[model samples]
Target chain A: MHTAEVLASRLGLDIAVAELERLFSQPGADPPDYGLDGGHRRPIRVAYQGVRGSYCHEAATTSFPSAAAVEAFPSGFWMEDAFSTLESGSADRAIIPAENSLDGPIDRNLDLLLRHPAVRITGELVVPVNHCLLAAPGVEISDLRRIVSHPQALGHCERRLQSLDLEVEEVDDAAEAARAVAEDRIRDTAVIGSRIAAKEFGLRIMEQSIHDEGGNYNRFLQLGVGDGPLYCGENRKTTVAFSLEKGVSGLFRALWVFESRGIRVTKVDHRPNRANPVRLVNRAGGVELAQMDYVFVVDVEGSELDPRVAAAVAGLGEFSGFVRVLGSYACTCGA
Target chain B: MHTAEVLASRLGLDIAVAELERLFSQPGADPPDYGLDGGHRRPIRVAYQGVRGSYCHEAATTSFPSAAAVEAFPSGFWMEDAFSTLESGSADRAIIPAENSLDGPIDRNLDLLLRHPAVRITGELVVPVNHCLLAAPGVEISDLRRIVSHPQALGHCERRLQSLDLEVEEVDDAAEAARAVAEDRIRDTAVIGSRIAAKEFGLRIMEQSIHDEGGNYNRFLQLGVGDGPLYCGENRKTTVAFSLEKGVSGLFRALWVFESRGIRVTKVDHRPNRANPVRLVNRAGGVELAQMDYVFVVDVEGSELDPRVAAAVAGLGEFSGFVRVLGSYACTCGA
Candidate 1:
C-alpha cells in the first residue's frame, strides 16, 4: 500500500495518494482575502521594524506591493512598538522577519507573537539577503578605515570583513548605519547594508553581496488582526504553540498525534515559558528537582480546516496543558 | 506503579524507583576529572568572549575558580575566535553562554558547536544575571539622560529604562559600554552591566537588579578538547546534533528512539543546515518542491556511557543522515 493509503486507513480519512502528493508538492495556492478587503476600500497600512531602507522595509513593500504606506518602527529592538501600532488600529497589517537562513529565528518577535494574542500570521514571504558595502561617493573600499552595520550583518560577513582588515562597529540597524555614513560623509568608513539603503542614503555601493555565504534568506511573516481569515488551500501551514501538562512523554505523544495522521511537521521551536520559566518536580519524599518549562512552537503542513489536522489538534488537548493555534496560513514562500 | 517503575519496565532497564528518584532530583554529582588533571601540572587557562567584566568573564571565573588566567576575546561577535583559540590548543578550555532565561539561545555559539567538531562540552553553569545601573561616581539616577549597554542588557531593562525616559545606545558589550562611559567621563550616561563592570570602571551603582523580571539567568557551557572525559553521575545531559536523510517522519522516529529508551529530552533547537540549507523534494513527472533542511540539536537526560543512551544513539543511525554526539556532561546547572 502507498504511504498515504496507510495513513488514510489509520486516520479513517478518504484522502487519496494523488491528492496527498499534489498537496505536498505545491508551494501553497493563492490565499483567500485576509482582512484587507482585497485592498478595494483603501490601501493597507503595514508596520515594520526598521528605517525606510532596512530589510524589513523591503519585505513589507515586496509582500504588500499595494500597501498605502509602510511605517517604520525605530529598530528591531523595539519590535513590540510595531505590534502595538497594529493592535491599536494604526496599521492594518504588520510585517516582521520570523527567521533568517543564517542567523536563525528573530527570537524577540517570536516572544511578541505569544504576548500579542490578537495578532495572527496572514502570509509568509522569503527574501534573499544580499549585503552590500556602501561608502560615500568617490570613496573606494581601500580608503575605508572602519566598517559599521548591525551586529548580525557584521557577523554574517565576518570572513569577508576580517580579510578587509578594517575596524568594525556594531550599530542598531543596517539602514541606520548607512544613514550615519551618508550624513557624516565619513571618508574613512564604509557600511554593510542593503542596496536600497545605499540608494536611500545617496551612498555608492562599493561592493555587492559581501556576505560570506550564498543563499542567505530571511523569512518574513504578515500579521493581521486575530483569526482574520482562514486560508483555504491544498498547500497550507498551521502554526501552533503549546505547553505540556506534565512529564516528557507529553511531547512525544503530542508529536505522535500529528505523525499518526501523516501530517508533515515543517518546523519546531522551543522557547522558555516566560510565566513559568522553571517547574519544580517533586517526588514522594518532597525532594524537588528544577526543570525548565518550555513553550513549543510547531509548524505543520496542513490547514486547520482539514479533518485529519483538526482531529490531530483535538488529540493534542489530551497531552497539552495549554494550546493556541497561532495561525493557519498559506505556505507562500518565495512568492 | 510509580513513574520510574513504569518507565524501567517499558525500557527493560533494571533501574529502581529510588535510584531514578535520586537521579531525577539531584542537579548532578561532582564531575569526574575531565582531563584537567586537577590542575596539578599547570594552571588551567580558560578563554571566553568579551572584556574582563563582561557576563561571560564572570561565568568563566565563577565556574573555574582555580584557573590561572581567564583570557577575553574581543566580544560576542568573536565567539568563533574563542572556539578557534580552543581548537588551536592556545587555550585549555573555553566557556560560552548557551542560553539566557529571557533572551533564549545564544544562536551563534550553537552554530559554532556544529561547525567546530573538536570542541566537546565538559560541564554546565547557571549564573543569575543581576543587571545594575551604573553612572559616574557623583551622578544620580535622575541626572541620567541616556543609557548605554549591550543590546540584550538594554532589552532586559527595557521596562525600567522606558519609565526613566532616557536615550538608549546599544554597544557590542556591556563591559565595553561601561568602559566607554568611564573613559569618556560621560556624566549624562548610565550603563547597564554587572557589578564587576562598575567596579572595574570605577563607577557607582545607581540602581541594582534593574531587569524587568526577577529570575534572569544565563546558562553557560564549559567546552574542552574532544571527548575529554565521560561524566559519571546520577544526573547527566548528553547533547547531540543531527540531520535527517529523507522525510519529516525521520525526526519523529529519532525522538521515538529516545522516548522508547525512557530518556527525557530536556531541550531541542533547530537551525538551518548551512551546507544544505534547502533540499529539493521531487515527485513523479519532474515536479519539485523546495524544503528547508534543519540541523537539530537535542539534550537528553543521560550520559553516553549508559547502555540505553548508547542504544538510542545507535538507533538514530537508522533515520538520521548525519549525527554527532556533541557531549555527555554533568548536569551541574546551579553549580
Candidate 2:
C-alpha cells in the first residue's frame, strides 16, 4: 500500500474515505435497490456553483475524488441555481456552503435549503479557509491600488486591508473576482481568493493566508435529491428546520423533546419567516400590533431514522408550527 | 403646542426623545447615579461610527433629536471603537446597528456585545433603510462605471445592481462612499446610500430607494455605561446574554425559566464561545473529539425587574454556566 493509504488505515479513516467515494458515485442506470450491497454502478456527476477554481468546486472534488465529472453551474451569484442542477437531474449531487466559522451561517443558503424540499443534505466537508492575495505577473503587494473579492472576504480581512490602504471592491464570488482581474489584467488590483484560483488564473501570489485569523474554516453540505439514505451504522448528525406555534411555551416544548431523549444539540439558528414576515399579536394593552415571524433551524447529534430520535421528532408535530428533517448523515466531527 | 410637538405628543414618542436628550447631554461631567431620575441634565453628546451621513449617525440623530451634538467618531471602519468612546467617558452613549431584516443578525456586532461587559444595551431603534443612488453634479445613472456601498447594502440590492451592469466596489460605509465620490469628482461612479447622505455630501439624488425591497429595516441598539436604570412601569423588553452549562439539559432548563412564567421570547441568537472555542468530549465509542462552545443571547418580553422575570433570571445563576443581564427597557414593539 502507498504511504497515504497506510496512514489512513492507521488512523482508522479508511472506512470514511471509502464510504464517501462509494456513496457519491452516480446511481446506476437501473433503478436503485436498497437491499443490494453496493447501490450505484456508474460514476457520478457532481455540481458546484462557481468555476473550476472556486471553493465549492474544491469541496466537491475533495468529497468525491472518484466521481466521473465535476460540473460548474453559473448560479447567478445565488446558491439556489446550484440546487436546481440536482433537482433537474443534470447532476447527481450538489455541494454548497452552509456556514463559515468567522462569518457564522450563510443565511441565504440555509433559507434556500429550507425552501427546496427535494434536496437533502447527505454529508459535510469542512474546508480550512486560506485566502491569498492574487495579482497579475510581476505585480507586487505594494503596487496594487485596489483589491476586489466577495464582500465577506473583504470583511474577513478587514484589518489587513485597512493596513494595506487599498481600495476594496466587491464581486459575486472570489473566483469570479480572480477571473475578472485575470481577464482585465488590472495592474493596480489584486483579488483575495483560494490558491487554486491564483494558479488557475496564472497570477502571482501577493500574500497567503491574508484572513484575520488562521484556523478559520467553511463547512459545505453535500446535497442529494430525495429524502435520505439509511446509512445507520455510523455515528450521525441530523439537521431539522422548525417553526414554533403561537405560544410562549412553543419553543420550550420543541426543545424538550430532544432533551428528554438525551440528545445533544450542536447548533441553533433562527431566521425571519419569509412567507409571513410579521404576525399580529394582541398586547395586554388591548392593542394588536405587528411582530416579526421566524423559523428556527437546529442540528443535533443523532440520526432522524433512529427510533429515539424519531420519537422526539414525532413529538414536534404536537406543538411545532412546522418541522421538517433537512438531512441525516454520518458524523464528520473533528475531521 | 406646535404642530410637530402636538403630533409627537399624540404618538407618545415625546418621552423617548426627551429622555434621550436629557440622558446624553454632557458626554459625562459626573459619575452616573443609577438611582437618579433624569440622569443627565445637559444636552446629550452622542457618538456613532462613520461620517455625518452614515446610517449610524442617522440612527443617533433620529433616536435623540434634541441632543446638543451628534459626534461622528472615525472607528477605522470598526464598530468596537465607537463602543470605546463610551468606555473612555468621551461619549455618553453609542448607537450601533445590531441586526437587519434581510441580513439576519449582524454577527460582528453580536460578538462585540458579548465581549464588552461594561457596555449594556439600554434601548433599540428600528430605522427603515432607504438606499439612494447618489452622484456628482450633472452625473446620470448611465454615466456610472462602478457603484459603491457597504457589502450588506450591495447584497441587498443585488438584482438591481446586476441589471445596471456596473462594477461594484465595497467601502466602509455608504456615506463614506458618497464622500469619496464627491471629493474625487468621480464622474464614472455613484454611491448607494441614504438620501440624507446625498444632501450632506453635496451629491445629487440620481435615483431614490434603489434597494430591492422597500420594507427593509435595520435594528440599532443604544448602549450605556452600566447595567441599566430602573425603567420600570410599562410593557418592557429585557435583553440577556448567557452561557449554558455543559449538560444536554442546560439549555432546556434555561428556557424553562422563561416559559414557566409566561414570558414571550422575541429573539434568540447564539455565538461561538470566544474564550473557549471548543471542548473535548469522550463519545460512547471512547473517542475524544472537539465540539463547539456557544454563548446564547436572548430577548424576552417583560422588564428584568419584574417579579416573575426577576425570579426566572435569579434561577439561571443556579444552573447556567454564566449569566449576565445586558439590559432592560420599555418595549419598542411596532416602533
Candidate 3:
C-alpha cells in the first residue's frame, strides 16, 4: 500500500486508492505527501496567494509541511508574481489553484498558466474546503443583512446564503472579508471563510461548514522553473499544449500521435488562440468564412524523458501548428 | 453579403467576417444578427437572465428584436429557469451565453446545457461587450473608493480597475450593481457595466469602453426543443457530447468517425465526467490505478439531417461509452 492510501485509510478519507497506486507504481514516482523532510538536502521555500488563513496558504502547507518558509503574496496579479518569484530564484516552488471539484476550472489561473512558459507543473494537491459563516461579536445570523466573501466561497455557500436571506457580495479574499467585518465594525454583514479566518480576525463563527456540499475539494498544482519532466520520478505524466494544422483530419491526426503510442490521456481542454483568435480560409468557391483557432491542453501518462513519449510529441510537430510541453508530474490522489 | 456583415461593416464592428461567411454558406444556417423580424411566423417570447439593461437582455434583444415579450429571470439559477421556461411552454426560446472572446467557456451554462436534454440549440448570436464605468451624478473617478459589477465585467476591466486603485466588489449582475449604486446612493463607489445599465439606473457614464480589450464579445446560443437538427434552415452545424470507451484509441476512433466522413470539426472541449469522475483500471502488470473519465463536447459542420453526419453520430456508439447530441445551430460570427 502507498503512503497516501495508508493516510487515507487512517483518516477515513475518500481518496482514490487505485489511482494513487498506479501513480506510485512507477519505480520512483512516489510523492513525499507526508512532508518534504525525507528527500531534499535543504528546506524549500514556497509561495502561495493571499494571507495566512487563505486556502492557497493551506494548500502550500499541505504540499510542503516542513518547508523552509511558506510565503504569502497578494491576490491581484499574484499568480504572475509567484511564477516570477520561481523564475528569479526567490522561491523554490509555487502553488496555484487549477480547478475546484464543484465549480470546475479557474479561468484566470488557466490563462496565466498558458501565458507563462517559464513555470512547469511538478506536483498537485487537493484541499477539502470547509466554509464557516463569521460575524462580528454580539451579532447573530438574523442581524446579518448582507454576506461577503471571495467569489468562489460565496458560490460554495450559495444555498446557505440564500436561505439566510442575505445579500451576497464578493471581495478579493475571504480572509480579507472577515478582517473587514471585524475592523470596520460592520454588524449587518457576515463573511463566509475558513474557521482560521474567523479566529484570525477575532470574529464569531455564526455557522460551520456552510458549503452546499461536504465533499467539495479544490485542486492546486505545484509549479517550478524549466522543463523538469523527470520530476514525476517513477510515475510519468506529461502535460502538453498544441494547436492542430489546418486540414479536415487535423484534430484527429493530432490525437493519433498519443493514441497510437498506447499512451493514456487524462484530460483535454481547449482555449482560443489569443494572437489569432479566428482562422479565415478561402473555400474552393469564392466564399470567405471564419474558422476557429484553438489550442488544446492535454495530460498523458509517460514522462517526456521516455523515448516513446518523446517520439509521440515529435510526431505531433509534423501536423501541429504549435506544440508546447506544459509539464510532467506525478498524479496526487484525492477525492 | 449577409445581413450580419452589412451591419458589421456599417457599425465598423470587429465581427469575424470569415466565420460569418462559412456559417451563412449553409443554405439555411444564417442568423439575423440585427433582429429576428425576418423569419419568424409571429412575435416570439424570449427569456433571459437579469433585468432590461443586462447582457442577457441585450443578447435576447439581438436575437429577437420584435419579440412579444422579453422576460427577465433572477440571475442566480437563471439558466435553469430559462430552460424551464422553454420546457414549460412559458417562452418560445431562450438564449444563453456559451463562451466569451476574452474569457473562456462559461462552465455553469456548459454543464446546464449538458444536463438539460430537453432544450436544443437552434441558432447562435455573438454580441459585442461594451463596458462603461458608471457612477452618481456628482461622483468622479478620483472620488471612487470602490467599484461594483458582475465578475466577468470586473475581469474585463481589470487593468482599468487596478490603475484606479479602487476596492472592487462583485454583485450578481452588472445592471444590478448600477441599480444598487443608484438605490443605495453609495457616494464613493462606481459600477462597471453597460451604458444601457447606467441609463436604466439614471447614473452618469463616467467612462466609456473601459474593457481591457477593444474587441471583447460573447457567443450566445438560441435553444428550443425536440432535436430540430433540421432547424438550421440552409446552413447546418451539429454539436455533440460523447464519452470514449475504455481503450487507448477510444477517443481517436470517435473522432475518426467525423474525419472519415469528410466533416470539419469546429471545436472540441472536454469536461470531467460528473457521474464517474475518476476511472480505476488494471494495467499490464495487473496493477490497478485511477484513470480519469471525460466527456468531449464537439462541434461539426453538418446537421443531423445529413446522412453522413447521422452515420457518424451513430458510429460513435461503437467506441463511445456515452453519446448525446446537444443541438444543431447556424453560427453567428464575432471575435
Question: Which model scores highest in DockQ?
Answer: 1
Over A104-156, each residue of candidate 2 has an lDDT whose tens digit, in order, gives 66777778888898888887655567788999888887688999988988887
Per-residue lDDT of model 1, residues A54-127, tens digit only? 88876665554333323333334477877887788777667777787766777777688898899887666665
Candidate 3 chain A — worst ten consecutive residues by lDDT sum? A12-21
Report the Cα lDDT for residue A77, model 1.
43
**Which residue pairs show backbone clashes in model 2?**
B24-B44, B25-B43, B25-B44
- What digit string (tens of lDDT, one per residue) describes model 3 on residues B106-176? 76766777888888877766556778889988887778889988887888898998888879998877787
Give the DockQ-based CAPRI class for model 3.
incorrect
RMSD of each: 11.6, 10.2, 10.4
- Alpha-carbon local distance difference test for all models: 0.71, 0.69, 0.67
In model 1, the runs with Cα more than 4 Å from the true position are A1-40, A64-78, A130-214, A247-249, A282-289, B1-40, B64-77, B130-214, B247-249, B282-289
Model 1 C-alpha lDDT per residue in residues B1-335, reported as the tens digit of each score:
67965654534321221222232224343322333233323334577776777888777666544333234333344778778888887776677878887667777777888988898877776667878998878998778888988888888888998899989899877788788888888899998998878877899998899998655778888787766646456557899888988845367778878988898776777887887776665544444544567898888988899999999999898778888998887644443
TM per candidate:
0.74, 0.69, 0.69
Between candidates 1 and 2, which one is better according to TM-score? Answer: 1
Candidate with top lDDT is 1
